[model samples]
Target: MSPTQNIVLITGANQGIGYAVAEQLLKHENYFILLGSRNAENGIKAAAKLDPSGKSVEPITIDVTDDASIQQAADQIASKYGHIDVLINNAGNNNEFTHYWKQQESKEEIKLDLAALRQIYREAYDVNLFGAAITTEAFIPLLKKANAKPARIVFVSSHTGSIGLRTDPSSEFYERMSRPSFPAYRSSKTAMNMLTLHYAAMFKEQGWKVNASCPNLTKSAFTRFSDLGRSPAESAVNIVRLANLPENGETGQYLDENGIVAW
Candidate 1:
């Protein structure tokens, strides 16, 4: 790897949006991409598939929900590159989709099973909220060592987490398909948005950029690869754009493909 090349690490990159982002970055000669997957075997396969030449991409085992796994990945990166120019917290879970569906089917008449709801919330938050937080904290030191002008941290979030859109009666999200569902996933992303703001504020003085983005219903395994949403490659455009932002680019904001999204 060239000493001047930028190092980027992306979690949950074996497939979906993460995979798409890696593919897009591979076109840039100055980028050394770290494809992070929860399973070591899967990561290796993804790296090989993404880079048959074995020159630009390297697989890294990083299970966002596990601290030990995150630490190990961070240690390995620090040992090799000493710093990371970009960290994409893209791994997320919507485990409570079924429970939320059940709740919506109740038509506001029946109370949800408390135990089941708790389990769903816990699992969703574990990956979407706590996991992202842990991963970001673990990589802060390496990010500070970036050779680039200003290191960046991007969080892959959703519009369902947008309080403005959720509350605005005139908004499509509030008008159509407004049935209560995915509470855990939605709330977790909301928390993540707030977390992004805090991190941006914390690092502003240090010239580190931290921001969150909504991919706008991408068709991937997360959506069972549904045709209703945009393709993963299409959705990755904004994410890759953010990752490649200039040193003076905006931070601490929520954005989508069109432009800046409301908090």
Candidate 2:
């Protein structure tokens, strides 16, 4: 694919790995980067930094949790860009991580506050899982409009979501996790993987490419504790690499910086 032939949209592009990806993509001549953020202020600020003259980097308001917001953003993108070459679903949240774990412990790991769990699930699933699904559904039409190559969708994911890595006895992740039922965070990512596969299978059958990627344990403000993790800029390398894959590249698998992660 030509460097200028793609228009890339990255959700949660205000900071962290998303922002880093924006920074890197801006350096590539002819690639238009849409910086998606919940906050307009942060979005504009990030866009300005990526494109000093505000020509290439376009700041767009998008809250993955809010359907109305997502629709509005989709409408705008459809009208302005006509086609989206690539989409990176990077928006996510973990606000209810601590409480859900505490309640699960109180229930002898058997029960939880259904209301609270639903609320937490709504936020996490909406952003990490459902948001990506909606974005894909909304923009798929525009993607097909692109005459260059099959539209690509890259789901930015985590190793925590890997059931294989979580259950492995010798894996570092299995040893480090403290919560027994911390499924809210981990499961949301797992759901993301499944969604990636669902799209991958469908796209593959239709001869299109869609994939998921794990940045590993990247050090960022999002996590309360992080050791042996790379900086946001460091982690962004793999995400960018996967996003820019050739049309015929791999899809429907979980990957990290080095290569594929088992299941």
Candidate 3:
């Protein structure tokens, strides 16, 4: 890789938004991507599919839910590349969608399985919130060593995390927003948004731009190929732009395809 080339690591990149973003970034000559996946085989296949010659893309095995896995990946990246220009915390879990919807669909006598709810919430935070936190903490030192000017960190957050939209009476989601609409998934992203700001403030003096991005509703495996959402490539547009932000670009903000999203 050239000195001017940027080394970007994206978690959960084997498919969906992560893969789409990798594809988009690879179109630019200076971007080298590390496709992070929990499965080594899947990662290798995804990387090879992106770049058969293996020039710009490399697959990495990383499970966001596993602290040891995240740490090992960071160490490997540090050993191989010395530093990372960008880290996209894209790995996430929406495992509670069914439970949330099921609970919502229940009539007057809803059986609340507290234990089950707790399990799903724990799973959601494990991958969606805590995993990203752990991974970012593990890689902070390497990120600071980036050769690229104004190192960046992008949190792949969601609009579902917006309390304003959820609470606004006129909002389309308002009717179903009262409760149990994937609260675990939504709250984790909310926490992630706050996390983004904290990292942004902490690293501002260090020339690191950190921001949260909402890809909107993207139809991929994550959504069970829901027809209501846009394609993975379409949802990837804003994320690609965020990843390419300049030194003077906006930070500590939440963005979508068009512009800034309301907090």
Report the lDDT tens digits of candidate 3 across residue range 1-263. 66678999999999999999999999954898999999999999999999998989999999999988998999999898899999999998988766545666787655658897798889999998999899999989998899888899999999889887677878665665555567789999999999999999999998788999998788988877878999989888888888888999989999888788777
Ranking by lDDT: 3, 1, 2
lDDT of 1: 0.88
* Clashing pairs for predicted structure model 2, backbone only: none
For model 2, how does the per-residue alpha-carbon lDDT over 152-218 read when each residue is reduced to its tens digit?
Answer: 7889888888888767877666776434655777788888999999988877865566778887666
Q: Which runs of model 3 end up more than 4 angstroms from their true locations?
A: 100-112, 170-180
Clashing pairs in 3: none
TM-score of each: 0.93, 0.87, 0.93
Q: What value does the lDDT take at residue 18 in candidate 1?
A: 95
**Candidate models: Cα lDDT each:** 0.88, 0.79, 0.88
- The digit string of per-residue lDDT tens for model 1 on 59-80 reads 9999999999999999999998
